[model samples]
Target: MNQRTFRTAAATGCALLVAAVGPACTGTAHAASPVGLATARVADAVRFPWLVGPVVVAHRGASRAAPENTLAAVDAAERQGFKWVENDVQQTRDGKLVVVHDGTLTRTTNVKRVFPQRAPWRVRDFTAAEIARLDAGSWFGKGFARERVPTLREFLRRMDEHDLRLLLEIKNPQLYPGIEARIVKELSAAGWLDRQHVRRRLVVQSFGANSVRTVHGLVPEVRTGFLGNPPLNALPSYARYVDQINPQLSKVDARYVAAVHRLRGAHGHRLDVFAWDVPLQNHLGIASTYGFDGVIV
Candidate 1:
């Protein structure tokens, strides 16, 4: 794996200044805002030993460059020197876990042509074998026509081979009730729970708070995060079960980041704040200005 670069303080200051002043600033001298100063302080204080700084998480394995949730996408991200990749997982009709992002397959796959009778192609309606036959990448481009929707086991094996960290989101837990336990079982069966290195690299996250709590109870060793723009009053409660709080990028600011850090949970754990769907250019600057622990770009 290759080393990743973080944002420098000078760049962060410039970005924040630009953010504070509208793009139409006409060389007007402005006083430093309280939010800007606080953001810088929080950024300096929130450093972790295992991480260099705010981590760069490739959302959906660099979805902009390749088909989302396919092994080819992950391989592309690895080739680009990204250490952290995020993907979604859901159970098929036969209870087999597959890597996919949508409730239906109309968008990213050739499901309509392959399963012409299976309209509204929900993932739960198909068995794993049925899903494996669908071309997951051709919709993106002809160059990726051979890409397949990889299983959770295949995804993890690829991540391990590349020494990459995974941010695994359990997509639509309500669709597959008891999926939390199933995911834990799958992880254990794959020897992920037995290896210390693998355990450190794995993180389970979900938009459902209950699902996050369920995973925390089932596998306390793996770090978990909740994805949503949760209420400010709910931070303390979320900290009890999750190690990180991943809110929408637009919802994040210095005040929100500080509140998350202040949440003290079991074993004196402070919830790390990560923002999602952040754009590529000036990402570090935005992360620093908002005091994020990680940015899912």
Candidate 2:
């Protein structure tokens, strides 16, 4: 949203960080994904007490301080003491996973200048090497000149180095067929599906239900969240696949939140709800008071 500044909502006993603007992050409940996953020495996940009041998950790597989705952002979030971080990921033409938020390369990178003929440079149209050559950070500020679009491995390497929890989003899954599986495969190869990471730190999410289900089907052990509010009647069915429901801040209200909490997830934990796109005018503070497990600014 805007450059992020960390402050405590002292009254609510919560830290404020936004995914877009600032944050109230997700807490760790426990330890412990499945796809082409070979048993390897997995990265460790730092644990936090479950049910803590809105945690500070740096939205796009403390976007206020660093370019969103770049290694700089990830490092900034870690430098700023954020325990968790959120980011969107998708595949390149050669099937490598890269961390980025937009479908087109125009917004965050120097794609237009680097490849003048490649109008509307859809991420899918470019090979990883082509995408890698573009400058991803100058648009945010010149201090980050030469910062490259990080592959998911690069991004996760930062997370691993810091032991930060991840709320990885499969941005626009429909644009990349089998992306769900690819993501799982990547995570597995990276040793992210091990018991410690799975039991305590990672949660994969998406607005697409099928994508969410596909992730669940691949690795039932990894916790999952669905990013839209389904009708109340459908919660049980969703519960069979996901551990949380993440709705935009506008759709969240006390009653709906209570209903979500009343259910149990596929893992037998109480269903959690994390609200995103929080409003202004102290509404962000108010949302924390609504008993939401976390608030995504």
Candidate 3:
């Protein structure tokens, strides 16, 4: 929907921040592989209210200003008055979680130059120490020379000090076995999973259904979103799994959106749909008008 039209439509309707994305779903009763989750049903969810106002989350830590996924990026995001900073995490060989977006180090780091022995295709196969040898920030520009791939702990410690909220994304779970569990462990250690008095605000999202399910199964308190394109796979089944569904906005048209808002839950309906990959400002403004809970570029 166009921004002006969306704004007008939003004004005319009782739009909730979180709406479902597709057709009517069976919700909990449809037969499918169980998410194996005990309901950590969100309380006071409707009371919390959809953030209709502009909420600028710096995608990959103010990536436009600083090197992505580095401390510099995060610091820049905080300085820019962005309360929420986004980043992606992957697992290392030793089961430590590290902040990075790409599967390989070739594009973001000078790994090819320093570790000539390592091929670009297989760099993720390296140990954390081996991965550390590459200069992650220099290519972004010399000012970020000290920036390196940060461990999850290091990032969390900095976030704790800054008191910034996080949009933590799990990138490519299938490649790294046990990564989901490791992430849970890390969050638990840092108290991100605590239901009471949450120290570090977080919203965990993943493209992998299994990864999202794993998070729901283990740490139900953390908000979860399943990221994907739509026409979506199943209305009833997928709806049952996530707290909210995040579909690429371009894929779904205006007609599909209203149906998503009607999605229900076990004790009644409790599903919300958010749109993603909103790279353009007009799209962000439009998504806000469309009643999306949050928009990510």
Candidate 4:
């Protein structure tokens, strides 16, 4: 697979800054069956080497194959054997949580064609019904026109059905308050909020320390990741909450990973370091050489 080289620090910083500024489940009574494909079974089923290695995380599902943040793309990623699929979530004006990469639909949907007057509708400004009416897939290609933005609940249901795992990124912490609580409530409603055994399924990540801390408070057992530039000292406040610290591989080197490993809170659990968007091959080398936990690419 041809890999995209990491861009300069300036570009990465700009993207993350805008992203920081912007921006599932439920079940019937208990049964013998697991709510989200038994955690034990999932852990046992895919024993990702405790050893660090390139974890084939689908960047917004199988984004290269389909419009990102859609069920079709997620399914394609699962079918293709990606160990985990990642997605970004934002709150709609109606307070419904939806799977989307941006704070607005204009760039990915034919919103302009349909709502000519609302040429620049922000995702936060539109109600769920209005947002749903926008064509979310045709921009990717005509054949994908059937695709629609999915709700967190819908996405989790599908994930449970397919027995797929995820690396969810909380995109906008400031734009919407109580998102962490909402996320936990949604997962619990879908019957996945509480699990006995947890090491690596249903991971959540965010560049915002507040968001990461909120998720940690809501579901402490579930693993959480903090994404940012490194040296580890830059965000000392975050070191306490996240289970893992994820940074762009381009900014991190062997020494950087080592420094992150040394970070510790009053309790034990040293933060696992996960680098993002590395080409598949470089990912292997970093994991093997540095003893880092994984990469999200």
Candidate 5:
């Protein structure tokens, strides 16, 4: 079946299941394994209205089909019926927030050829205007030669148009100190923070715990996620501010998932566990088996 068709069927099935059972039944069911341990049943854990089942977040906006972190990729993801899409945000030399995955432009953009004098081609060294002059998608394929790196504002507008959720990551936080406040300011200026649905559709995440805390303080209504797995002992500290714990797939297990679910924070909210960088279709089952609340694919 085609992507759109498959997504429609999946949505229908999920709706029926939810109607028959309930949202609580959407979570994975555990059973005893041969190793004398419990294995979780494959079930939906993400409870958001836009998210129907075990969340399938499009990494860098369906990057497997189009150039990563470009408008083309975002369009591809929407076409494929992904409600949640992930992207990295970094500030340019002029302090403009642009969506790109790497600290350097060499891997995804034709930066070296455009600016031969700048050897390292770090993103922070170039202005947004200069970054826009380079082709971001041509490196992936010739058909996308016109694709350019989109500013955070532009990307957020596209997401709003499509009614898609965002898993926005603050990349290289140390390089851009106070980026959390800036992100909140931009979101507010775009009227995202004021809209109830828009706020629910947005999640701010970062590898830096301090950055996550900053976002929590600036926009308490918006959900914040921490990118890496801290020690089990540190989960309580994380629960104090973060709404979600996004750990690398390798770092999380059934026990870890249980521990995360058990954590309670201010306002009696339970912590959510989302696993990241799941690149293969086969691993989706593995992630669900481990009882991850969601997976970034």
Candidate 6:
């Protein structure tokens, strides 16, 4: 395999990054399993010349390999030669944007132990400074001990250093009112909303249809995706607001894929579809068979 070199800084105390390259690698700075094979081999695959095959996105920065949403997880994705990554973002109590999955800090961080009284430690129930004190990575392993929940700015900086593309999910917009504005503000301040970046390397997605529509109105140039398998009749309306329709792995087939491709997005491009949380190689074969545009694994 051919190889090259690049370095990306891990958040705060983590080490510098060094990722190897191979034929499967497609970075600029750069630089799933099984039995469903018959479905994957279905005839009349939707082929887009822009991509050789379905784009594979590292979920929460390679969650199985590192504590999710931490800089460590992002680096893990880079090390595995993944160019595109998908991570969730939520706002802190002080309205600071942070890269984390859950609306609460319980699962991925040591919030419970740190603030014993802060039961049901809602992410918005604590300040970023307070949340910063918890160990975000130790739950996954000792080597990752002290990994902290990164502020959105910190996460984006790391991603830029690695020259990676991002599919940033607006985790739970309802929990954080005006979050759409806050998110766009942060991305804009980070230079990610620039035409070049927005056009080539960034996407903002939300499970909430209204939140996604709000995002489209805020910055239509920045392509956005709506997460869900809405009824086929809703396709035209959804296409008006989103560039992609990202549904769960179990919710699609060739007919669905073809339906999405037939429409033009708000951005004037073919609407795309990406399945989320897919597991096993057979599923990947099926994505190929069903002609998905991407998969969040």
Candidate 2 at residue 121, lDDT? 95
Model 6 Cα lDDT, one tens digit per residue, 1-297: 111111111111011111212111211110011212221211012111122246778778856556778897777677666678899999888999889988888987888898999999999889989989999976665657769999999999999988989999998899999999998999989989988789889989999999999999999898899999999998999999899999997888789989999999998999999888564233345576787888887
Comparing 1 and 3 by lDDT, which wins?
1
Tens digit of per-residue lDDT, candidate 2, span 88-193: 9988988888999999999889998989998879998899999999999777656577799999988888899989889999999998999999999899988899
* Tens-digit lDDT track of model 4 for 105-134: 887777778777874677888777877787
- lDDT tens digits, residues 192-227, model 5? 786664446888899999998888887777888999
Model 4 lowest lDDT segment of ten? 22-31
Task: Give the C-alpha lDDT of model 6.
Answer: 0.75
RMSD of each: 10.3, 10.4, 13.1, 12.7, 10.8, 10.8
CA lDDT of every candidate: 0.76, 0.74, 0.63, 0.66, 0.76, 0.75
TM-score of each: 0.82, 0.82, 0.76, 0.77, 0.81, 0.82
Worst 10 residues of 5 by lDDT: 35-44
| lDDT string, candidate 1, 1-297, tens digits | 222333454345445544534221112221123443333233223222222457878778856456778887787677656779999999999999999999998888899999999998999999999999999876766667799989999988888788888899999999999999999988887767776744568889999999999999987778898998678997778888888889998876799888888886533677887798665446666777798889887
Error of 2 at 2 (Å): 31
**lDDT (C-alpha) at residue 252 in model 6:** 83
Residue pairs clashing in model 1 are none
What's the residue-level lDDT of 178 in candidate 4? 83
Candidate 5 all-Cα RMSD: 10.8
